[model samples]
Target: MSENLWEHRPESGYVTGTDLAGYRVEAIDGHIGKVDKHTAEADGANIIVDTGVWIFGKEILLPAGCISAVDHPNGTVFLNRTKEDVKGAPEFHRDHHTEAPDYRLTLGDYYSGRVL
Candidate 1:
């Protein structure tokens, strides 16, 4: 697995507020989805993507660490990972793993291939 893209990095000026909802998310290869919601907490930030009809209506949460850039003008969130990487990630269960720190750890481990 690859390392967390934003590890040890401070929030870039491009990383705006939760107002990013509805912005299209672009993977390294191509478009993935739009931001359904976003949350910024003490630990980190995350974005809930709504892949409308792209993968049978699948929605996934991506850690802010995965973000490589934010193009507010274009209404897009660029990710460091490819679409395949995000597709193979552990499925997101609404309200089940959102608040679970252990679940997040597992997800972080899954992405970086290291215990977090």
Candidate 2:
């Protein structure tokens, strides 16, 4: 796990694999709508932003690179963007969003096709 995803460092590199159940990824300064689930690639090198348990919910994507750091004491996963930025980026949709063009432009470039 450690070898795959790099740990979130301010002036350093990426963060490593996260403790899936013990983390709460936030939109820098936004309210959390419960984390629905996580999907890891690179054999767990990175995780995908799942959907929220609430209705009118949409799926999200979190690249390991975007992770700023992990706060072990509170079990929180920190992201490096504001709420507006996150929502505006590309709202994840299971069907349409996963299409070829969408993947290449949005998530594919974001992830660099690698988990980390």
Predicted candidate 1 versus true structure: per-residue lDDT over 50-111, tens digit per residue? 98887779889888778777877888888878888889888888689777777788778666
Least accurate 10 contiguous residues by lDDT in model 2: 1-10
| Residue 83 CA displacement from its true place in model 2, Å | 0.5
Q: Report residue 64 deviation for candidate 2 (angstroms).
A: 1.5
Name every residue pair that clashes in candidate 2. Answer: 5-16, 6-14, 6-15, 6-16, 7-14, 7-15, 7-16, 8-15
Question: Please, what is the whole-model Cα lDDT of each candidate in the order they appear?
Answer: 0.75, 0.49
Query: Which tens-of-lDDT digit does each residue in 4-112 have in candidate 2?
Result: 2322334323334444553676757854443344444443333345436422466665555556666657666666656655565455765664333545356535444
**Per-residue lDDT of 60 in model 1:** 90
Name the runs in model 2 displaced over 4 angstroms. Answer: 1-18, 43-46, 50-55, 95-105, 108-116
Candidate 2's TM-score reads 0.56
